[model samples]
Target: MKKILLSSLLLLVCHIHYAQVISIIGSTSPAGNWSTDIDMATTDNITYTLTNVNLTTATDPGTTGLKFRQDHDWAVNWGSANFPMGTAVQNGANIMTQAGTYDITFNRSNGTYTFIPAAQPRVGIWGPAVDSQNGFGGPDVDMTTTDGILYTLSGFYFSSGSAYFRVNDNSTLTYGSVSFPTGTAVEQGPSIQVAGGEWFVTFNRSTGAYSFTYPSIGILGDATSVGWLNDDIDLITTDGFEYTLNDLVLTDGEVKFRKDNLWTTNWGSLGFPQATGIQDGPNIPVTAGTYDVVFQKSTGHYLFTNTLSNPEYSVANVKIHPNPSNAIWNLKHDTTIDAVTLFDASGKIIGNYAPNTTEFQLDGSNLSNGVYFIKINSGRDFSVQKIIRN
Candidate 1:
């Protein structure tokens, strides 16, 4: 009975010493030396939590490593030394973190960690004349990093050269590497090489991983002939990625650009957005008119220029009559007429009359019974009228 009681007491003491206690050690200054223990909760047997931890600092952009451990012991820690954010934790690995205030929770039983960032990450891209393709002097193009650790710059084009990921918009503080796989570490290195073409680029500063891929781009919306069809009218490729569509008629509606004619990959904007690199933004409104549209695939910028309107038809000034005239018709006008030309429905000139007078006669004895277009020139402007014959 005494031996059994002693064994039971030892088991109870072991459970109390090994359960409900956790802490973290990392690359941030607040994490203190890995040697010291930042004790967490003792009440929960399966989970541990920490709050209001600030990971932002000057060195924060490069990397922020973290790992949850039992008490102050490294042998019982969890993480993959270079693991990216949102990944499941692994024993003996280091968790990669971004610069932001966050509430971090770890599940000891499942080897998974949850990070709730308090703020967004700052991201942008820059390079020399060869890589940016915007001459040597430039303000770098910005990027979106909503997932905190992954930064993406879409519709990017560059020549065969190199560039770096700018840190906090500061050119001096930047990171770079070669063509790398997703989820690799982003260390301080030389510029990355690129080919000339349009691309969607993604970079993870925490893991130094980067990648790029080609994209299909075109315009779509209600203003076009296809009327909001995802793959209606496509822009003509000027270069490998830049596009232009000449003489397009648009109605009073909205428009957007999509990849391969799908809503899954699309872009739009508020107002008559132009000249700047846009994102997956809002819809752009337009009116009924003919235009020439230009889209820069490398930058996601678009421009629409209205074409010249058709010449007006002065029905009040000119008159052509004789009721299906099989003989001849009189063309009368009040203005000083310079010339009059008759054209068939196919736009082929049937006859040219230099009737430099206000009144002229149109002979239809040798013409077919059909519709024709009569053009009149006066002063610096021109007008058109439709004439019928029997």
Candidate 2:
């Protein structure tokens, strides 16, 4: 009896430690704008559009107020027919003040889609097909297979012209294996038809670039005839084979691609590498070592770091004080005490101090208005916090 009891207790402890609580709280005006607060296990997909945001608690899993514009015309001003329009910035909270209809979407471990809108739109936000209780922005696609399995894809397509695909029951949509004509751009559409058994889709043999319609699986022609080369480029596989731009490159090394105005790299099978470089347009050659690399176009900077080994330090905490500090600015920690080090986001350490000091007051009068990080080290434990010095 004691053995069974102890085993049960251990199981209970594990369950409690792994359990996550995600809650969304806020006030939305009937006009389609809102301010909200969210507290969750992780901010994996939490997004908001607003101008000002605030956090009221100091707990690791505390709550934050997200602000955004909820007016319907805001989207029009930005040339978007959508009701909400505005920019979103996430600090401890998110803020957006554009005067249009807008919806904030978030995803966490429990699956995706927790929409926060100022007011319900006429068409309403689409919910997930699997879990109707949760909502997602834009249309949702459901592909059923003969094995009684379902697949769904979300997000808008960013391409020139759109392409379409179909599937039938028992038949699965095999990406990469299917070939698309050169310059063919595929965009995800609102929906696609898959027969009950099995089916396949083919793109037109046209040589021009194509892209998908927003929220729909349907393809559309480019509004302007700017040609195909600049839209989608051809790719050469490591197997010494050439694949169309439509073929999804799946390999152990790095995969590079250009999106909008930026060049991006995904470490592929190399997992995380010590470094990665773009050999060609979208081809990334990773170092034999492993390290995750992230690139920012606006700043023209590449950030390389190790993947998460400890969940506690995976994401850095961020705090900002907009008001000018008369004396000093306080930097606080929410976890076990560790050595605190400050940097100017340029990877240069500005100051370092012992931990458990409750607060580290910095002489902000000499600092400029910009972003910085306060890195905390506890034994092998490491975490970073963002601080904006006004």
Candidate 3:
């Protein structure tokens, strides 16, 4: 019985020691000799904690802190020997780093601890131009070269040995385009990668024109045909090329076509006089069998040059009462009407009547919940009103 009691007492002591808590104390120095100490004490359920320390004296003594609670896998490893940096309590995954020497440290009581060494300085491509424009809300890098050439830096390194760098052509670099200067140096740290090497600094130039390519072309018509008729015909060059048209005038004789910003073509005569209203033009005459069609422009109030064959319906005076009607709808129009038609949403005629009186009331109560259009035709004029059936 005594032996069993002694064994139970030893087990209790081991359990108490297994649940230990650790605290870190550290100080920052401008001379670059910063140091930290970890202290451990017995606890009930507390596991581990993590904190981040900044070496650069930029803000708040250059020290930023991060903590992790209840961490089961807590271990420390040497991050860099030259920089004398150490990482603590990485739970999972292998530690990755760039070129340079590093040391590792690990400690655990009830659980196993593992230390993984990694390199330092994590070399990568850094863009000075992108960083500078970040504050101004501009493009990461601007291509000001007339040839439309752009350059970006690319390269990789493991920590900080001799860094390698190369220049990548983001835009086609050609002759006469602005290029990056050769032999540029870059710095990488924290989360940044700097470019290095002579070629990485310079940009390649291109010798191409600096204009945007537009696939569609536009054409304008003379003032007389300028109305609706102007939109009827599309213009194209004789060689089947597309050209934009502009600066049209309404003269007594014909409409002329111009190329680029100069070189006017012979007057393209129209069949009808400018005074006569505009109507849709006939198909273009075929000389070479086919031609590219350009965009149409407004010459006048109408879109074409030909006069409308049917007489237009005009509404003179119209009236509606109890406009915000809940059931019945009443409509009145001037002149004797020939026919009155009501149309639904699909443009289908729902009701028709032979015109007699000037006033008519539509029994909207029978209509479903929706909107309807009423068309009234009188001799040469017609009027339409929107009626709600709610």
**Candidate topping lDDT:** 1
Q: Per-residue alpha-carbon lDDT of model 2 for 1-390, expressed as tens digits?
A: 999999999988887776444333433222222333243333322332221122222111123123322222122111111223333322223322222233444333222232233332111112232223332332323321211112223332222222233232111221211123222323333322221111121223122132221121110112112222223332322111111122222223433433321222121122222122232333343333233333321111233344433334432443324334553666554554466766764546677778565445666567777666555554334445456665
Reference-based lDDT, each prediction? 0.64, 0.33, 0.35
Per-residue CA lDDT of model 3 for 261-303, tens digit only, reads: 1222212323222111123333122221112222221111111
Off by over 4 Å in 1: 1-117, 129-137, 180-185, 216-257, 260-390
Runs in model 3 deviating more than 4 A are: 1-314
Clashes of 3: 32
Q: State the TM-score for model 1.
A: 0.30
Best by TM-score: 1
TM-score of each: 0.30, 0.23, 0.24
lDDT of 1: 0.64
TM-score for predicted model 3 compared with the true structure: 0.24
